[model samples]
Target chain A: MSPRGRRPAGSPDAREAILAAARTAFARDGYRTSLRGVARGAGVDPALVHHYFRDRAELFAEAVVASAAGTGAVDISERAQAISRLAPEELGEGIVRSFVGLWDGLGGDRFSAVIRAAMSNDESLAPFRDFIVTGILGNIMDKLAPDRPELRGQLIAGQLIGFGVVRWLARLDEVASLDIEEAVALIAPTIQRYATGELPSSAA
Target chain B: MSPRGRRPAGSPDAREAILAAARTAFARDGYRTSLRGVARGAGVDPALVHHYFRDRAELFAEAVVASAAGTGAVDISERAQAISRLAPEELGEGIVRSFVGLWDGLGGDRFSAVIRAAMSNDESLAPFRDFIVTGILGNIMDKLAPDRPELRGQLIAGQLIGFGVVRWLARLDEVASLDIEEAVALIAPTIQRYATGELPSSAA
Candidate 1:
């Protein structure tokens, strides 16, 4: 069934409001946020939240995706479209530019909130992990990479995740201070290698 | 003056005790840990912790390094020496192998504690940041890389940090489930390129 078909009849606005409230709560409290608090924030009944989302984990996953796509930041779908348009060789630079832009646009607190929340509790981590591995990177790899797309997507994820941790979360001087272009220049090749370049023979 | 000269004459064991206590406390409470509590854990007066280390930050830093070294896990210094001994082209594989081994040996909890603590507070992040940028990666670059060591080291740091985050912290299946040698084969070349391969012209 279509996702729209699954929804209970009501104004779609309530759903959006709950998602928006969830984004704020998850960003502020990580995974520990309560559905009642989210419902109150959205001015909806707690039962309505349960109506929209199966549980808190589902809510958090939806909230994170909504936060990434719905906030003033660049939309992930649009960003994915932009990435898809780039020549295969240019994918590295395009991905890095898009990633840096997305995070920079989202602001550090929001970005860190996603990571810190994931790190704070393993159960909370599952949705974010799925969002990253399958929803984002894996989808990109499936479209673009020629071989071993799963590994390629994962390697790219590792590079980008590390870049975010070092530059944004850890705020290391050498990396955190680099201008976007400089970072793109230095990191894009590595990503390019992961995305399309030849990898060493796997021992496994 | 020598470090020993500054210390009050006493058994060397007290200094070690404070550091051990600090490691446990920092791992448990992160940067929010207090000197009095660490001192209590060590069976030493808070004044004694002050005498051995300048402040909480320094103590935390020392404790981290010591934990990396003193635990049954592989020592950072010895790991560095091993990396230094490898041929330049082999550096990537050696480094990845060492990193995976070290983290695996240290066990996930301790490794996560260091990263989680850093993420918890900006003040706590500084010492760990410095340790990653300067103490470990930068030092490696200085001794081994032929040019642009700072940028190379930072890039390498970003990659390794990402790998750890993805593999250990996030536990994404594609990368996380790989045998260590598989990881080494896939990632080492990327590290090698950053270590010695030609980088794109800097925008700066």
Candidate 2:
């Protein structure tokens, strides 16, 4: 059911308020927290949340993206629409752009926090893991070569994700502060390698 | 100039006391918290801490790795040894073992707290960033083709590291509960592709 199926007294503003509150609450508490909790935090009725958001996933996504208010980075939820831009040669930068943009933009903290939490606590994200692997990362892989394209995409995705963890999450000075181009320069080659690298005999 | 160099009398368990205090202090106040304050918390003179540890880096690493009174994970200075095992293929599992063993073996909350704190704050991990990149990750790359190994290591490392963040820090469901073999099976291939895959033509 929608958290707020119809706008209450203060339509969009209240919805925005609930979304903002959901971002902070989700950022701090995660996706499992009750609608009541969000309502309380937003100073609205729990039903109001349902009216606006279809459910927690929708709310969570909105909160995840909305929380990432300022960073001009790419947003993953917005990725499907971006599929047209996914060329093989430009793949490395495209991969980096999506991830870097996500964190650099608005949802870095919430997204990382949620993802990190999901990694450790098996209860919350059990259902979504395969989807992420086969869906998002895999989708990128399918665009390349079946034999190695997915592996390559994963490699590229892996490194950029690591760079984000160090710079954005772990606050490693070199990574966190490294200029974008320098980082891209350093990171893109790996992406290029993964995007189109030959397999090791051992692996083959 | 060791914090333990000058132990004050009346603190017979000064060493243990210092570690306990350091963990609490770091968790509560993070890396910026004063060693003197930690000493005060442990009811010992700051000199006693200096006597045991050379400085905050030494202390943080110690505190970061602490297991219990007499048994911490391993000495902070000793962890540099883990870096030596970082081969291209071995990097992911090795780091996985290092961190998982540390936390699991210690069976304490200290490292998690430090990881959480360091992730959000850069200054807290100034000493570890290089260790993470050059010492640990780069060493692994050294085992690969030099031309693009760093990029490779970084990508694979990101996935593994992010996996850790998700499993350990974010406490995400599906990943955290994954058995070691299952995790390695799932994660290692991606790691391998990055380590030894052919360089994409665009990359060179």
For every model shown, what is its TM-score relative to the native structure? 0.72, 0.55
True contacts kept of each: 0.78, 0.22
Per-residue alpha-carbon lDDT of model 2 for B86-196, expressed as tens digits? 555575555555555555555424444545445434444543454455545544556666666656655555666665555554443444555566555555555555666
Q: State in Å the error of residue B70, model 1.
A: 12
Taking the candidates in order, what DockQ does each have? 0.57, 0.19
What is the C-alpha local distance difference test score of each model? 0.72, 0.57
lDDT tens readout by residue for model 2, A110-185: 5556445543334344433433444355446566545555444444444555667766665544455545565565
Q: What share of the true interface contacts does candidate 2 keep?
A: 0.22
> Which residue pairs collide in model 1, if any?
none
Chain B alone, TM-score of each model?
A: 0.68, 0.57
- Model 1 chain A: weakest 10-residue lDDT segment is A1-10
TM-score of predicted chain A against the true chain A, for each candidate: 0.68, 0.60
